[model samples]
Target: MVLVFLMVNAYRELTPIVISGRTIPLKTIRKAVFIFCFALTLILISIFLILFNQGNESSFLKVLFEVTSAFGTVGLTTGIAPHLSTFAGLVIILIMFIGRVGPLTMMVSFGFRKTRAIPQYPEEDIAVG
Candidate 1:
């Protein structure tokens, strides 16, 4: 749910907004991208940590649900949280804290400031696998 909302909000932010025959420039698109990526990374890490700590005790889907719920601060659980390892429980608690404080807020609080001047260099075509 929260992940869906983050993706939707990011899409909306990336899209240009028009009002009264004028298109509003989106300067925060990078910020939106950063937030989305950070959230995704957190979710993935949480899932990995829980799965590693729990071993085969819980299914992937259940771990995913628990992590997402914690990240969303929705307080929804599948009754697996209590049985999770201490480290896994801590991970969920951290996720909940980050979710409540918000990714952007966490980034800003951690000294991620936006620069006023954006440096642009010449585009180069590179090969990729």
Candidate 2:
């Protein structure tokens, strides 16, 4: 979240979220809020959908907690870990993989963009006094 704020504020050179050709302009605060909220909603929705299909009778909050645990790569569980279906286990594994690798991947992707180009201007630097 802090990094997202830095990206939206300090790192003004990078585009926030570009899809196809539609570049919706968003300010630093708005972009941060949007990203945070959207990601939370999406994660909750995916978790709920998967658990629902697995015929769960648990409340949404319980499922959300489980989903957060998986995403956070935490070992804690509400006694539901062993009973999950194979598909659900696989999904959790995949989420765990993402939780482990996602930040590294994000850094790499942020380092390289399809629209980036070599600087056309000459470089100059100030000397330390």
Candidate 3:
């Protein structure tokens, strides 16, 4: 998704473009990239939280699987789900919630933003390809 945003921005910035047909807006790509990054960060944080708490109780791969399952909501585990600490369980729950509703959308629904009305300038035609 990040690559998509980069490529679209680059394409839009090219010289002597022609608008042959409808094209996706860069804003959508930017939002997708943002969501992808936020989900990646949340996954990493959740995995580390479980790993640090689990210690040598399980293999790293097992911890990773558990974390993935939690975020994926697949309801599968390597027999370690029963032994998760309270903190670890909470972390998994957080991951599940974000996974279900997405990080950015969740933040918006949670009132983490204030919409602003930006006045639009008069439309003008521009060449694109």
Candidate 4:
């Protein structure tokens, strides 16, 4: 569910962007991606809360520790990484991929349009500190 949301939102953000062709505003794409990533973080937090509630035998801190480690794709945890269920591990893997590649690359693979480069003005010197 979260993966799907991320994929779709990323597509929406990156699809219409073109440097040579002015189709959609770049600012619009940036804002949408920002909001989508924010929402994804919130969704992951909500999932963590639910998992902790269901696995009440574990301490809240432990649950948070494991969840954070999993979602961050850090592969680090308080000795709980080996204990996760197969389904949970798969979720972690998917989340890790998403976190690593991010929404931009995901969208670029499918939604982007390719075109030949256009010539641009030559660079001018500017003072540097």
Candidate 5:
């Protein structure tokens, strides 16, 4: 379902949609992708670290499966969830909520609003390593 939403958003972004003499910009697509990737990375890393600290003795594959399952809200497990720590369980719940509601929807519900007018600032290049 998430993938379907992403694909649909991407298609809408690629194909221009004009209504009432104005082209509608699908800016949510970029925001959604960024939010999804950022959340996925953060969740994966945090879960991996938590599992590592718990000394579960489970292989990386099993941990990955559990995290992905939670993120996808698939309710599938590798029998390791029962042994996980409380903190890990909370993290799984967070991921499950994020998966079910979607990162974009969660952000929007949390008062993330898009402004009609964006203020542009002058660009300046700074020294970089």
Candidate 6:
């Protein structure tokens, strides 16, 4: 699943840090976030197209709004739920689950826990406004 993929990726990237006490690569985190965001965008687009093509009398904007609302776990509706087909209702339920347990939280929960050792590096303060 998605969580497995994230754990593999995180383990590969964080192994050095966990074993050698090195910092995680920022670029790795950036790339992971970018990919996740792209996937989420694609899912939204697919939902929009399907809803719009249904010709169920709901406006495209309304469909988008409902999809977002469901995905965000926000119960607001533009008065279109009663007409949605069974499949669409199922999609909404899936979205609600995704919203409730954010993708990142679920993914990160798959990682193995690390134990801390005594600190070796001294703390230094950098000037900040």
Best by lDDT: 1
Best candidate according to TM-score: 1
- Give all TM-scores, in the order shown: 0.73, 0.52, 0.68, 0.44, 0.62, 0.51
Candidate 5 Cα errors over 4 Å, as ranges: 1-28, 114-129
Model 3: per-residue Cα lDDT at residue 82: 74
lDDT of 3 by residue, 26-107 (tens): 6765677777777778888888888898787767788788887877788888988778888888888888877777678786
**Better TM-score candidate (4, 5):** 5
Q: Clashing pairs in model 5?
A: none
Instruction: Compose the digit string of candidate 4's lDDT tens values, residues 19-68.
Output: 44445565666657664775467446645754654575455676566665
Superposition error at 61 for model 2 (Å): 2.5
* Off by more than 4 A, model 3: 1-22, 115-129
**Which residue pairs come into collision in candidate 1?**
none
Please provide, for model 2 over 1-129, each residue's C-alpha lDDT reduced to its tens digit, 9 standing for 90 to 100: 444444664556554554455554566446556556645765766686767767855556666777778877777677676777777777777667666666345445667647767779877967755
Q: Tell me the lDDT of model 4 at 36.
A: 78
**How high is the CA lDDT of each candidate model?**
0.83, 0.64, 0.75, 0.60, 0.74, 0.67
Give candidate 6 regions above 4 Å deviation: 1-32, 35-39, 42-46, 106-129
Error of 2 at 114 (Å): 1.2
Instruction: Rank all candidate structures by their TM-score, best first, as comma-separated numbers.
Output: 1, 3, 5, 2, 6, 4
For candidate 1, give the lDDT: 0.83
Please provide, for model 5 over 21-129, each residue's C-alpha lDDT reduced to its tens digit, 9 standing for 90 to 100: 6655567456756776867786778677757767856677877888888888888999988888888778778888888888777777887566698899999968765
Candidate 1 matches the true fold with a TM-score of 0.73
